[model samples]
Target: MFNKILVANRGEIALRVIRAAREMGVKSVAVHSTADSDAMHVRMADESVCIGPPSSQQSYLSIPAIIAACEITGAEAIHPGYGFLSENAGFVQVIEDHGLTFIGPTAEHIRIMGDKITAKDTMKKLGVPCVPGSEGGVATLDEAKKLGAEIGYPVIIKATAGGGGKGMKVAQTAKDMERAFQTARAEGKSNFGNDEVYIEKYLTTPRHIEIQVFGDGKGRAVHLGERDCSLQRRHQKVFEEAPGPAISAEERARIGKVCADAMADISYIGAGTIEFLYENGEFYFIEMNTRLQVEHPVTEGIFGVDLVREQIRVASGLPMEFTQENLKINGHAIEVRLNAEKLPNFRPSPGRISQYHAPGGLGVRMDSALYDGYSIPPYYDSLIGKLIVHGRDRPEALARLGRALGELIIDGVDTTIPLFRALLEEEAVQTGAYNIHWLEHWLETNLGEA
Candidate 1:
C-alpha cells in the first residue's frame, strides 16, 4: 500500500478521497489553486500545496505543478477524483514518467478508451453492442452528411474525446446535420483538443444505464452492476441510482458479462464505466469513462464496496478481493448532485454561503466541503456536494431522498435542491417512467410557474 498520495482535484470529491485515505492509514497531500486556499480539502489533508492561480490551465490541470507537489511532499501516487486531468492520458503518462503512480488506469488503456473512435471500435471487436453509424471519425461536413443520410435522421454527432455533454449535437434533419456537425467539431477541438467526431443513431426516450467494472492489474475483472443515470439534463447526469429499476435479473447478468468480457479482452485495468443507451429493451454502447465516475457513491451504498479504495489497492499491485459471485446488490441507492446554480434560467450563483446545513440519519450520506461563509468560486464546476440515500427499494429510496433533500439547507446562493424537490413529487419520477429528457421537460413546465 502507498504510504502517501496526492489528490489532484478539488471540491467534495477531493475531500472524499482524503477521508478514504485516512481510513487506510495513508497520508494525503492536497494540491490546490490560489482560489482554493481555504478549501476544505487543503485543511483536511495532512499536507497541502498551492499549485497556481484560479484558472484551471495554470492550476488544477498543470502537470508540472502537480508533479512538483508530489515530489516535495514525498507522495508516491496521485488520485485524480474525476474531472480536470483525471482522464488525460498524457497527464497519466507524465506522472508515471516522473516515477509516481497514477491511481487509475495505465496510460495505454487511458489512451485507447479516452478517444471515442478507438474505444467504439475496440468494443465492437469484443462483441459489445454499439450504436450503428460511422466506422471512424468524419473529418468534413460532407462525410458527416453522408453518414447521417445512411444512418437516417435524428442522429447525434459526438466528439471522439468528449464528456460532460460538451462537443455534442443532435441533428433531426439533413439541414440540421450540416450546422450541428460543424458546431460539434469546433467545440470538440476547443474543449478536448481533438475535433474528431463520429455519428451515432439517437434513440428516442432512451434510458442511460452504465455498468461499473473494476480490474486488478493481473487481468481479473468483475462488474458491480448497473446505475440508472436516466435522470439527466442537457446530456449530463444530475442524479444516479443503483441496481437500475428498469433492468431485470436476466438483463443485469447479460450486461455485466458483456462489460467484463469487453474489459478482459482489452486488458483494461482499474475502475471504469461502460455506458449504454437503452430503448425498447435494447442496450447500445455509448462510451466508456476511463476514470472513476462522480456518481460512484450510490454504487458503494448498494454493493458495500469502496471503489476508491479498490482503485488504490489495484494500483498497489493487490488482487481483487472478491469475484463476480461475491458481488450482489443489497438495496436501492440514489444520489442527487447539489450544484451551485439556479433552475428555469441556468446561471451560476457564486458567493459566501450564509447558512449551510447537511442532512443526516439512517440511509442518508452527504459528501461536501461547503460551510457557512465559504465563498463558491465560479472558476470551476458548480457542484457543491452529493446527497446520497439508500433504502430497501426504489420507492423507499425515493422517499428517503425526498426527506433528505427537504432537510438540506443552503443560503446565499441559488441551488438546484428546490428543482429536485419538485422532481421527486412528479408522478413520472415516482413511477420510474421518466427518461433522459424528463427532468428538462419538468423544469420547463414548473421553473416559471406560480
Candidate 2:
C-alpha cells in the first residue's frame, strides 16, 4: 500500500479520493491552483501544495508541476480523480518513469482505448457488438459521404479522440454529409489536436448504458453491473442510475460478463468503463472511458464498494478481494449532478456560495466541496456537488431523490436544482421510459415552463 498519494485534480472528486485514501490508512496530498486556495479538498487533505494559477493549462493540467509536487511530498502514487490528465497516456508513462505508481490503467491500454477508431476495432475483434460504419477513420469528405450512403441515412460523425460531445456531428442525409464531416474534423483537431474522425450508423432513441469493470494488471477482472446515463445534455451526463432500468437481469449479466472477458483478454489493469448505446434490445459499443467516470457513485451505491479503494488496492499489486460471484446488486441507486448553472440557457453561474446546505437521510449521500462564502472559480466545470440516493427499487430511489433535492439548498448562484425538480415530475423520467435524445427534446419543449 502507498504511504502517501497526491490527488492530481480539484473539486469533489479530489475530496472523494482523499476520503477513500484516508479509509485505507493512506495519507493524501492535495495539489491545487491559486483559485482553489479555499477549496474543501485542500482544507481536508493531510498536506496541500499550490501548483499554479487559475488557468487549467498552468495548474491542474501541468504534468511537471504535479510531478514536482509528488517528489516534494515524497508521495508514492498519484490518484487522478477523473478529468484533467486522468486518461492521458503520456501522463501515465511519465509517472511510471518517475518511479511513481499511477492509480489507473497501463499507458498501452490507455493509448489503445483512448482513440475511438482503435477502440471500436478492438472491441469488434473481441466479439463485442458495434455500430455499423466505416472500417476505420474517414480521412476525406468523399470517403465520409460514401460510408454515410452505405450505412444509410442518419449517421453520426465522431472525433477519434473526442469526448463530452465535442467533435461530433450528425448527418440525416447525403446533403448534410459534407458539412458534418468538415465540422467534426475541425472540432476534433481544435479540441483533441487530432483531425481523425469516424462514422457510425446513428441509433435513434438509444439509451446510454455503461458497464463498470475492474482488473488486476495480470488478466483478472470483474464487472460490477451497469449504470443508466441516458439523461444527458449536449453529450454530457446529467443524471445516472445503477442497474439500468431499461435492461433485464439476464441482459445485464451477459453484458457484464462480456466486458469482464474483454478486459481479461487484453490484460487490462485498474478501473475502466465500457460504454454502450442500447436500442431495441440490442447493445452497441460506443466508446470506453479509460479512467473512473463522473457518474461512478451510482454503481458504488448499489454494489456497496468503494471504487477508489479498489483502484488503489489493484494499483498496489493487490488482487481484488471479491470475484464476480461475490458481487450482487443490492438496490437501485440514482445520482443527480448539482451544477452551478441556470436552466433553460444552461449558462455557467460562478460566484460566491452564500448559503450551502446538503440533504441528509438514510441512503442519501452528498459529495461536494462547497461551503458557505466560498467563491466558485469559473475556470473549472460547473458541477458543484453530486446527490446520490439508494432505495429498494427505482420508484423508491426516485422518491428519495426528489425529497433530497427539495431539502438541498445553495444560495447566491443559479443552479440546475430546479431543472431536476421539474424533471423528477415528468412522466417519462418517472417511468424510466426516456432515451438519450429525450432530455434535449424535453428542454426544447419545456424549458420555457421550467
Candidate 3:
C-alpha cells in the first residue's frame, strides 16, 4: 500500500479522499493553491503543499506543481478527486514516467474513453448497445447534416471531448440542423479546443443512469449497480440516487453484468462509470467517465464500501476485496448537492460562513469542508457540500432527506436548501416519475430559470 497519497484537488472531494486514507492508515498530502492555504483539507492532511496562486490553471491544474508536490512530500501516488486533471491521459502518462502511481484507470483507458467518439466505438465493439449515429467524427457541415438527417430529427450534436453540458446542441428538425451544428462546433472549438463533433439520436424522456464498475487490471471486475442522475440543470447533475428508481432488480442484474464484463475484457483498473441513456426498457451507452464520480458516495452508501480505499488498494496491486457474488445492494441512497448559490436563480453565492451546522442522525452523512469561519473562495466550484441519506427504501430515504435538510444549517451565504425543500413537496419527485427533462421543466414552471 502507498505510505502517502497526495490529494490533487480541493473542496469536499479532497476531504473525502483524505478521510479514507486516514482510515486505511496511510498518510495524506494535501496540495492547495495559495488561496486555499487555510482550507479544511490542508489543515487535516498529514502534510500540505502550496502549489501556486489562486488561479486553477497555474495552481490546481498545473501538472508540474502537483508532481513536484508529490516528490517534495514523498507521496507515492496521487488521487485526483473528480475534476481538474482527474481524466487527463497525458497527466497519467507523466505520473507513470516519474514512477508515481495514479489512483485511477490507465492512460490508454483514459485516452480511449476521454473522447466521446472513440468511447462509443469501443463500447459498440464490446457488444454494449449504442444509439444510432456517426461511426466517427464528422469533419464538415455537409457530413454533419447528412448524419443528422440519416439519424432522423431530434439528434444531438456533441463535442468529441466535451463535458459538463458544454459543446452540445440538439436539432429538432432538418431546418434546425445548420444552426445547431454550427453552434455546437463553435462551442467545441472555444470550450474544449477541439472542433471534432459527432451526431447521435437524442432520446426524449430518457433517464440518465450510470453503472459504477471497479476493476483490478487482472481480468476481474464488479459493478456497484446504478445511480439515477437525471435531475439536472444545463446538463449538470444536482440530485442523484442509488438503486435507480426506474431500474428493477432484473434490469439491474442484466446491465450490471454487462458493464462489469466490459471492464474485465479491457482489464480496466480502479474506478470507472459507464453512463447510459435508458428509455423504454433499453439502455444505450452514452459515454464513460474515466475517474471517480461526484455522486460516488450514494453508491458507497448502498453497498457499504469505501470506494476511495478500494481505488488505492487496486492501484497498489492488491486483489479486489469483493467479487460479483459478494456484492449486494443493501438499501436505497439519495444525495443532494448543496451549492453556494442563491435560490430560484442558482447564481453563485460565495462568502464567509458565519455559522456551519451539519445534519446528523441515522443514515445521514454530510461531506463538506466548511466550518464556522471558512470563507468560500469565488474561484472554485459552487458546490459546498453533499448530503447523503440511506434507508431501507426510496420513500424512507426521501423522508429522511426532508428531515435532514431541515436540521442542516449553513448561514452567512445563500444556498440551495430551499430549492430542495420545495422539491420534496412535488409528487413527481416523491414517486420518482421524472425523466431527464423533468427537473428543468419543473424549474421553469415553479421557479423560472433557476
Best by lDDT: 3
Instruction: Name model 2 segments beyond 4 Å from true.
Output: 448-450
Candidate 2 structure quality by residue, lDDT tens digits, 1-450: 899999999999999999999999999999999999999999999999999999999999999999999999999999999999999999999999999999999999999899999999999999888999888888999889889889998999999999989999999999999999999999999998999999999998899999999999788889999999999988989999998988999999999999999999998888899999999999999999989998899999998999999999989988887799989999999999999997679899999999999999999999999999999999999999999999999999999999999899999999999989999989999999989999988888888521
> On TM-score, who's better, 1 or 2?
2
What's the candidate order when arranged by decreasing TM-score?
Answer: 3, 2, 1
Count of residue pairs whose backbone atoms collide, per candidate: 1, 0, 0
Cα lDDT for residue 231, candidate 2: 91
Cα lDDT of model 1 by residue, 1-450, tens digit: 999999999999999999989998999999999999999999999999999999999999999999999999999999999989998889998998998999998888888888889988989998999999899989988888889899998999998888889999999999899889999999999987988899999887999999999988666789999999998877878889998888998999998999998787666778999999998888999888889999999999999989988888888878877799989899999999989887667688888999999999999999999988899998998999999999999999999999998899999999989878878878888888878878777766777521
- Among residues 3 or more apart in sequence or in different chains, the pairs in candidate 3 whose N, CA or C atoms overlap within 3 Å are none
Measured against the true structure, the TM-scores of the candidates, in listed sequence, are 0.97, 0.99, 0.99
lDDT value, candidate 2, whole model: 0.93
Question: Candidate 3 at 239: error in angstroms?
Answer: 0.5
Worst 10 residues of 1 by lDDT: 441-450
Cα lDDT for residue 329, candidate 2: 92
Model 2: weakest 10-residue lDDT segment is 441-450
Writing each residue's lDDT as its tens digit, candidate 3 over 97-136 gives: 9999999999999999999999999998888889899999
lDDT for model 1, please: 0.90
